[model samples]
Target: MVEKKYDVTIVGAGPAGCSAAFFLAKNGFKVLLADKTTFPRDKICGDGISSAALNILKEMEVLKKIESIDHHKIGYVKISSPNGRMMTGRYPIVKNFRDYGYVVKRKEFDYVLFEHVKALPNVHVLENFRVENLVYNKDKVTGVAGSHGEEKIDVFSDYIIGADGVHSKIAKKIGLFNDKNKHRAFAVRGYFEDVQDLSDAVEIHYDSQVMPGYCWIFPTGKTSANVGVGVFNRFNETKEAKELFDLFVRNNKYAKKKLKNAKMKGPLKGFPLTLGSFGSKRSSGNVLLIGDAASFIDPLTGEGIYYALLSGKFAAEAIKKGEPNRLAGEYYEKMWAKKFKNREFMPGYLLQTLMGSRIAINAAVFIGSVSKKRATNMAGVISHVLPKYKMIF
Candidate 1:
């Protein structure tokens, strides 16, 4: 067994963990950033990086690396209703922020951030480390114990951050696991080459076959995309996600047209999403959760990268400069509430619930297609580039 000590032990080296590690290392903290996989590995995702997420990436100083890569820049969005009504418009622009977003494969995106963090002086980057449990000092989490190949490793830290995705071992060890399907969704994605009519716009198609969810065609190039479908776990309990995906590719009017001549470039991958419900137990004692572990994914568009990066920043802030009188967990909860979870975002959640019905989605798409302003508003809200209230007003 090998023992180590650090100011913080992050259980995952994905966006959230890397974000936290970057900030903490810059502040001279001894940080241990570990992951079960090696660098440049593929993560199952839609690969759509929101403008909001790009803001954080810029701060991390890794955005330039991503910009230098051959990535798709999304300037527009196209959304279609179940009955085939469609709205296509430019993404709404805000002052000082570019209207366009990017779609880079996770292998590249995650690796860029990981490389940036791994170079920091105070951070220890561990690959192929699988966390199995938490070490407790009389009920207060004090460290983490995991395996690295054949070696057992134990790390002591002041705080343990679970940035390890939805099925986080740290989250479960801290008793925050919930079985409710209301806050969960299932998504499957596959890359396709030569997808026809692929534009700079990210496309989302709604249908009765996958209500409470949508299928997305996020272009990765001029003629290819990461195409996928997401359905609420509750709605998907009796359904097969792969079947739903095949049906969307072969039957959904818009998707069929775009994918009719497309060739699948890889295997279909499926994963669970912890939708942003906000009420999940985010922190306890000296342990905190971020990203998917905290259920920060958007309920409407099934986007998590923005929230993941933002939550990582918040977690780092809480640990580095939190009030001395308050627990870091308490400060983290406050920061998360102020930044990501609040009353202002409630309308979006309500809309996500309403989106379960085919009639509601069709009506909304019809309204959006009526005018350019309406279309822009629809795209902005759905992409989380604008507040939900803006769409209603």
Candidate 2:
């Protein structure tokens, strides 16, 4: 057995973990980053990066690298109603900055981020390791016990950060995953190559019959795109995601034509999408949770990459400014509330109301058409921007 110590030990080298490691190591912390899987692991996602994520990447000096990669610039979002009515809106990423987001393969993106973290002098990356359990003493998490291949190892750290995905073992072990409200949706995603007639735009189709959730097509290039469907778990009792997705593809004329000769290049993967105000209590003793471990995904849209990065950075900042025990508890509670508390509540309420009635959707579109600014304000609410009541009404 080998024993080592670190100022902070992060489990799961996903976007959140890597972001945290970068900040922590850069700040002179002796950081240890470990992951069960190797680098360049594939993730099932729509591959759409939002402006918030772009800003964070720019701050980290990774935006230029991301732009150098093969990606498509998305300027507008076209949303379709269940009745075949369509509404289009532009989300300009603000002037003098990346005006729009990009769509890229997670394998490439995650690999780049992990590589950057590994380059940091104060960071040590242990690959091919699974954290089996946390070693706690007197109600404080002090270390983790795990195995790398056949060798057992113990890593002692002053603080532990759980950046693992939705099915977080740390959250479960600490009794945070037992909450009922934390369960959001079941999602299936994949990519298609040789797609045709694609533009620098993302399409979101909201058809109750085809998908209770939304079906998205994010263009990655001229002839390829990332296509996926997310179905709320409550809607899955009577529907299968794959069947609905296939039906959606057959029904949508554009989707049918573009994917006519396209082939699925990867295996379809399914994962749980945590929505709204769910997850275990984020801060407890010496352990902190970030990203999907805290259930930060938007209930309506199923977008989480931005929040994941935000939470990861917040966790690191908290650890840097405060002592281990105090920081772990304070960071989890304050950051969780400041960044995500309002975001979690409003979306679920708005989505439940909108999706429950066709009349409301029509009314919303009517209001949007009559007043673009107001509509934009209404849209901002779902986008986590607080809007005046007059704008939405």
Candidate 3:
């Protein structure tokens, strides 16, 4: 496209980027969606796709494409308290979306999303294009500067959408990075086969050692599953998340039983997660941040995909109704708040803050282990069918 100025430029071709590009181009706007890597690349994630995210894909006519790929359906969720008490419940339908969750590697899921957005004739996608700098003119973001192959490529656009993820260059460049350990989580994930009790249901374990974080076994099928553990970085400072994961799998009685004769299929990978919903400026000047770049991962569930899709579509709506050069940043924030942020934001933030301690987690486990209603209510919280405050012990 050369120096041809476009209506919108999106960095990072993940779900959020593709979602933004999807709407912008469908509306007949010239758009560019660029990523640092090519398709089928592995993205470290829980591999749990909630019904909320699936509904968005269905609305976009892309859910069927995702379903055609290798995946597993989740109808049950089992949560193990730190004291070894287990609670299992059914997934709840939220906002008309089915209760079933889907388990597919982010690598596979992202490929379908990227490919769908890449097909729009009006949307140009550049893989292996790493964004290194933001193009600025008089303190307003005009475009981006990056390298493709051995050559530098620069493009100008009226608006920039930062979907580049947690370590986003655009978010950092615009001074939106909030560096607080309490607001972040570090975790490791790996694939495993031959695990016992393999089912479509996803299981989460809360070991006393990994308080405020968790270990999960989300099945991808009847045989293989994504298994791993995460820990709140602040409380888990000296402990390697991988080592903790191993400790759980090797020592936790239930984990040991389930992992008996299990073989890890791949190397354990780690990723940083931004948690909680803080009242921060999501847009500044002509640039807006969505998805992980905006820190929308759920504090309780550690789910980001649903929020990413939510933010991307809401952002597109804001951009669609605004004047180009003078689009109001506050308008974008207000729109995001009304769509999904206002009702859910404060509660998520408060939950994260409260759960950061060891006492709350232990107490919840103690209470949840004895109360069937409490366990079911917690499942509702996970499904986002019930308010987060319901599970607060």
Give per-model TM-scores.
0.96, 0.91, 0.94
Pairs with steric clashes in candidate 2: none
- Candidate order (lDDT): 1, 3, 2
True lDDT of residue 205, candidate 2 = 71
On residues 1-393, what C-alpha lDDT tens digit does candidate 1 reach at each position?
Answer: 788999999999999999989888887779999999899888899999988788888999899998998799998888888888898877888765668899999998888889989999999999999999999888777899999999999999888999999898888888886546888888999999988998889999886666656899999999989999988876558777788898888889888888888899979999999877766659997788998888888877888998889888888888876545537888898888876777423565787777777888888778788888988887776556788766656
Better of 2 and 3 by TM-score: 3
Residue 102, candidate 2: Cα error in Å is: 1.2
Model 1 CA deviation exceeding 4 Å by range: 323-326, 343-345
TM-score of model 2 relative to the true fold?
0.91
lDDT of 2 by residue, 266-287 (tens): 7877777776573346866667
Arranged by TM-score with the best first, the candidates are: 1, 3, 2
Mark the regions of model 3 whose C-alpha exceeds 4 Å error after superposition.
Answer: 339-342, 353-359, 362-373
- Report each candidate's C-alpha RMSD, comma-separated, in the order given: 1.5, 2.6, 2.1
Per-candidate local distance difference test: 0.85, 0.75, 0.82
**Candidate that would win on lDDT:** 1
**Model 2, stretches more than 4 Å misplaced?**
93-98, 178-182, 278-280, 366-393
| Tens-place lDDT digits, model 3, residues 1-393 | 357578899998899999989888877888999999999788999999987788888866799999999999988778776777777767765668687879988999999999998988889998999999999888777899999989898889988999999898998999887567767888899898998888767888888766666899999888788888987765668878988898888988777888898899979899999875656778888899899988878876788898888788877877887765466466788877765565576787676655666566667766666777787667777766677777764
